[model samples]
Target: MTASSWLLVAFPALGALILLLAGKRAKAWGHLLGCATVTLAFVYGVILFFAADTKSTVDTKLFSWIPVSALQVDFGLRIDALSLTFVLLITGVGMLIHFYSIGYMENDEGRYRFFAYLNLFVASMLVLVLGNSFVTLYLGWEGVGLASYLLIGWYQGRNSAATAAKKAFLMNRVGDVGLALAIFIMFKYSGSTGYAQVFDAVAAGKFPPAAITAMAILLLLGACGKSGQFPLQAWLPDAMEGPTPVSALIHAATMVTAGVYLVARSREIFNATEDGRLIVTLVGTVTLLLGCVVGCAYDDIKKVLAYSTVSQIGYMMLAVGLGPVAYALGIMHLVAHGFFKAGLFLGAGSVMHGMNDEVDMRKFGGLRRKMPITYVTFGLGYLALIGIPPLSGFFTKDAIIEAALGQGGWRGWVMGGAALLGAGLTAFYMTRLMVMTFHGKERWKDLKSEDGRDFHPHESKPIMWVPMAILAVGSIGAGAFFALGHRFTEWLAPSVGETVEAHHLPVEAWVISVAAVVISLLGVLIAWLVFRRDVPVERPERVSFVTKAARKDLYGNALNEAVVARPGTWLARALVYVDNRGVDGAVNGLAAALGGGSGRLRRLQTGFVRSYALSMLGGTFLLLVALLLVRFS
Candidate 1:
């Protein structure tokens, strides 16, 4: 049955193809078909999860992809602990998101098309995890980008949706260059692109330290783009312009986590260079604070959650960046995040569904009476996100916090401090969201949407609530299930190696956990104190500089425009100027000179007998003079 792993990708790919080919005709059953495909894949993945053991990695070859004497690349599936873990996460959460979409998109006319795009997205993500070679992974990598572009731009009539999709595509392309170059380096050095061959070569010191470090850095670049870390993070919040299910799936469950998977998979290369690991850790730390600071200033509910994801993934990046000691910790947080974050996004969707699609938290108040199920589920997720005990976030995230502090020395102090502060800010913003949305006065009573729609909040359908309920449970319990007795780290040991701390701890683990929980609760308390009163419908203009900066994503977009976009534009224009003035000028000048000389010479050919005789006489006289001079000499 493990040999039949091809069926995993085939099911969803086939679903997408059918939906596309069937077109409008598939509307009757397209969503059902889409859900069925992912459900089947999830069921199969569960079977494989139970059947596979810790130390065994099964490589099932599909065919000879690029057969050559100089290089060989086989298309194959790698059924290992790492790949299998991602497969289950992608398919399992993907199945729930699909079901939620069926109800969320019930009224939209293009629901069928949306499901097709979802299936394609899932299929691409599955291949990204399952592929045995970097080249194969690139194929799925591009596929996921395309599918995301399609889905994010699904509401083509909306200018924001179109622009957001373009922004996401362009930003991801910047990172993809790094991935492609890294693969080229791998092929040039190892003469193969397969994971086993490349990892083995790195292990045997076949590649130089420069090459290893370069690969590690380039891979991190790719991860940064896909995972929305640091500089490339501006696109993530904009992506919420798509459907909420798209937000839940792409941001929370599958696509954003691809970077963590990449870093974890290439553990050998990073271990070869201290600089590479430190850079990853630094990027994670910077982005963690960036996301937390910005998340605090958002009035839009979805954008708040989006920035929260940026910060949480930063924790995962930080954990993996710690090397063997915390690779499993990173992945464990990733899984737990998938649960609570997806629940939060779906809960946001539920809020929008009930509140006539208002996204500004300032416009929402006293909605718990109208949306009890959504409130309960979203509150649980919020608790999990704020690191309340017994919840998944408390377990998974606290482990990363402890690991960061365990790095020892000034490095530990810096990163661990950032992680702790991020937890506090996360609670503040999330609590601000919860209070503004579900408590306080009923702000929506007097408000009318831009579309002139009055707010009438109600519970979402069972289809939507059921998925949120299940995820809420996971949000509450997945951390304990994965972290208790070191189950998660040990399970991942076969893929990432043993979790051995290289540095001594600065303080006890319990000390770090206690500090984190206290800071988190303090954040929640401050938000409540501030927002438990009335929230004005319009944002105040007389805010501090920090508030203004946070509202603008800390000016990340402006910096990119100045540093990358404007410079690139000027360079392109300069190339065009040179092409026209220099290259075209020379060629055009030569042609004009030839044309003028021919025009002057044509006057001598007057097309008459006298003109012909005079030209012949001149040519003869010149030839005779030249011959006489040579003979005399």
Candidate 2:
């Protein structure tokens, strides 16, 4: 590694520190500084992406972090093809978000604090991607979680914002426990938690099958919590309480993807355990289907996107379970999703800005005439998300489907079928969102304000528009990289050759691609027919009970409250009561008894020198008589 690699981490951290220290007095400068820092980091990322040897690890040790008799850890950076790809995504897309935040948050009261948190988020994500050891990676992991909580709750006055932040933090702690446990297990089995050493041990088959499976599954638990998979997914939909830029950052760019990154990083161990792989596939399938179902029910624009994030992450998880080909497909999807999702979020933010904070699609209409830039960019993003042919999502989603089908069994068909259905739902909901929000007549009728002035909507400033344009371009064109899939295979050949076979079946590829396009178009047509002709937003409520159940996420929150929250609360209360009444009461009672005995003894010694002397004399006379009697006997 070179000095440029260190710059990637240092620049953003320094920017965050500067913005934090300067406070609101330097708000404009802070935004510029933040954008500049990420821009520089992105440049370095690109340089490294082209210059570095894709097959080898670029290691740079900064210093010794922990030294002990039993363990040692170093602060180091590793740049491989996978890490480099993620770095580019984080920095490149991160710069766009930062640039967009400049306009999105221009009028906010906590502008400086917002920029500070944004820069800190970028710094922590860089640490997460660059770290060479599990200890370092975990440090960055928790750091990003903390930053996410802070950003999500930036509007401290709002109770919902604080609640969402707390939920995100608490849910992530569940995953953190699994991650920490997995680290301990890895150390116990491999004697080292460094990525290099751990991979070496696994390759040599030093660990038992049971141990490997346990570690992999535990790690998957962590992935589930962080990636917003089922059961732990409640926090994400609520996370929309934050600023829209923050939603773009956390949900689209940085925080949620960490779990997928972790699983992909630990692919060797996961591949060794069939049970673990099956669990990953099942979870991905369920999350994919569930997200698509719930996303269709919501009218809140950002919430729709949040559920879509869950659904897309499900695709990434599915890719991981399919082995190496699928793993790369997952990463590919991650990158492409970052582009379009971030663009979609920013577009939503632009809409909110135009409508004076109106987020319900029912209240918005004919926005295509008012905000053409946002409409075009967001429409392109939606198309990409729905996996239209020649778009980025198509290539990545196609790769995953092909990998699943190649497995050639009922399992493959099930997972592949679920993914195909998810694609259709993605198209339907996104199209519904578009037509409802942009295609109909203006729906905002009431214009009541304190000043009694009429409300009018307008477009966002250029700062926000430019970033959307850049991301929209990426969403349309980034899939061209898949045309060089053979090259990618060659580049990754050395690292994953043993477990993954290289095969390109033209018939399989074409079939999956054609099927995806057909399903997507079907969804689009259904949405267009249902929503486009309707004048006043009348969605039919006559649906099956099972459909309604799926629409409400199967009442997941109720189940979580009953099964997880209630038991956890009761256990906590029981422990607290025992500590206060049982343990503390016993200790206080013993102290009181000892004090009472001491008081009695003090009274017995009460203030008489003559009494004390007489007692001593009586004791001496008794002792002498006893001694004389014993001698005579």
Candidate 3:
């Protein structure tokens, strides 16, 4: 079993390599190969999960990866509950997405290449979760970044896709720097970057509290960047410029969750630093609100869902920020989110497929009759996302809300209130999405698409809806299955440790749950009352200040430009000026002076013998006069 661990990553990686190398030869079967590889990985992971005693850590040492002095790193796999949980999510959902993409991208000429990139992404994500050391994780971290850049920019002809890919890549690099620096610090202080070594050192109080706090904060910075949290979140919504399947894969299953995984995996570091934990909590709270508020204003189906992903991930970050008491809960939300969010995205894809590839929800209404499978599946996912009872989100999300309120005091009230408010807003926007797209009168009846095509709504083929149906089922039941009898927390205890539930709550647990349900209902009611009447195909020319702000993503991009981008650009230009004028001018001036002095000296070097003879005679006479005067003195 230890030796076989490598197969987890090997399968998809092999598939990707073959797809790329075989080129046109593999085009006929490329999508099949991609789906088969992920399916095989899922099968292996399930077998491994049931076959092994998950209560303990399983480290499979392949070889010495880095054998530097005092820094011995092993190329190994970490097989345990946490890693396996992500493995299942990635491969299982990845397989479905791969299958869905077959139908989604069937007519596209580069479908084979697209599948190869997907396979590579899956393999990179596996490496990220399964690696035993930070360096190995970084290797996969970079690989995921590269694969996402490729996949997001898959349509090279579109400037928006290309620009969005670069934006996502650059923003993530800001966070990756934090992660890289934290690893360097870990190596410097702990003398090792492997999980066990650094963790053991931390447990022994080898690192100072300040150092620990720094590490935790740095890691959080990276998490925020990858997860689309505050100040680093501007890239995610724009990333919808990619294909719908790419959006589903990145937002739901793999990339966005990487931040949560990083935090949960490093629970020990966070547990040691109250300041770090508090800052993380604050960032999460702010981000959730940002995502929710902005989500309410978007007409583009994919961007709305993208912001929803941001908001949901913010919930997970908040849960984990509460420390051990909610680490498993955060992860639970992540898993639940993977199901419902993926379904939502795929459903959006279905809507687009039938509606002339149009993304504007304003152009859609009463689509449920045209695409019943999509409507049913999407509705289930919507219910699950908004915390409707007995759905996955009700089980997972309410737990997080309960955990927040349980923290107690002003901190509890503030965070818990913020979370509840976010919940309400989440319901509002999602309901708005549903009401505008599926509940109201058909808005596209007399309208033509931006591409001047007729609207002919139809159901997607089984190849696409089958995956949505599966994900919808998961969206409905996965939360309950993971939450029942404390099973998820217990299963995760071996890796993340047991979370001691906060006992001194400001309010009863049932109160939080009831309040959450009421707020969600209220949000839904308000959206129905407002949007169920008529949503204009064109945005209103005039709106309130708040509405305008929300539409602008709360000025997040502008803030980034003002605070980071424009200043950085100016600084770069300033640096170039200084290099040219200050540094180069001095060197050039010195060269000019030497050249002029050489020119004067060259004049004395006359080619004529007469000038040489005269110069020699004058030199001899001056020497003789100086010698005579010295003798007289």
TM-score of each: 0.97, 0.92, 0.97
List, residue by residue over 1-633, the lDDT tens digit for candidate 2.
Answer: 453587898989998998888887776677888889899999988987788887776778888889886788889888887778778889988999999999999988778788888889989988987898888899889989989899889889999999999999998898889989999988987888899988889889998998889988889888888889887888888889999999999877799899899988888888788889888888988998889988888788999999999999999898887776567778778988999999999999999988877777877878888899999999889988999868888988877777766666687678878988999999999998999888977766553322454447788899999999999999977867656565554554444432254254435577778988999999999999988864454445898887688667678878778988899999999999999899998999899999999999888695799989988999999999999999998
lDDT of 1 by residue, 103-126 (tens): 999988888889999999999999
Worst 10 residues of 3 by lDDT: 476-485
**Model 3 lDDT per residue over 510-608, tens place:** 888899999999999999999999788898869999989999999999999999899999999999999889899889989999999999999998799
How far off is residue 106 in model 3, in Å?
Answer: 0.7
Positional deviation of residue 234's Cα in model 3 after best superposition, in angstroms? 0.5
Winner on lDDT (2 vs 3): 3
lDDT of 3 at 525: 97
For each candidate, what is the lDDT?
Answer: 0.92, 0.85, 0.92
